[model samples]
Target: MEFYTKPGDYDPINYVPHQASHGTKELWKTFWLLLGITILDFIIYFVMPASGLRNVIFIFFGIVKAYYIVGAFMHLKHEKINLALIILVPTVFIVGLVMGLLYEGNAISLMK
Candidate 1:
């Protein structure tokens, strides 16, 4: 059996597809937005005293950052709705489960 039938056959081992350059505008925007969010998080961390509200604020910011990172950098925003939902629905449920667990644990600790 011959591995390659012809002289100029396709080589699976040495395949590098050509990719066009997409503009960096969207990337720069994502960078700036992430930076602003980080700065805001830092300011809020120092300005607010340690409390439930402060923690909630931090969580909110974290979720926002995660959403932006996934949507922009991961290219999920441009994906079809079904594909995005497939990746995101379980994530939402998992986050909800974690928050619920935290709330229940805090309540149980208070009762102890």
Candidate 2:
């Protein structure tokens, strides 16, 4: 029935929000970490040899970025393991499906 208690009833150990200080710090840390990874990816994109290997590297970086973005920004890191796996398992399959499509499309184009 009641949300906020009286001044004397305020208990630090009993109440904590999702966006606590630790969570905020983690969010910023994730932001900077992702920024660094993106910069590194760009450098690799320009410096690496133009080949299938480079494309695979790009896909690997993409998967890593997606994992961090989903876990941190989407707050899946705090979720239960089974719940997180529910989303992640389908995601792995989707990524595989995309890679297969790309390979098939490239083969078709080469045939043409």
Candidate with top TM-score is 1
TM-score for all predictions?
0.73, 0.69
lDDT tens per residue, model 2, 1-112:
2345587766667765445444488788889989988998899988987898988888788878888899888989988899999887886687789889989999999999
Tens-digit lDDT string for candidate 1 (52-76)? 8998998898889898899889878
Instruction: Score candidate 1 by lDDT.
Output: 0.85
Please list all clashing residue pairs in model 2, or write none if there are none. none
Give the per-residue Cα lDDT of candidate 1 at 107.
100
* Candidate 2 residue 97 C-alpha distance from true site, Å: 2.1
Worst 10 residues of 2 by lDDT: 14-23
**Which runs of model 1 end up more than 4 angstroms from their true locations?**
1-21
- Displacement of residue 46 (Cα, Å) in model 2 is 2.2
lDDT of each: 0.85, 0.82
Sequence-dependent TM-score of model 2? 0.69
lDDT value, residue 89 of candidate 2: 83
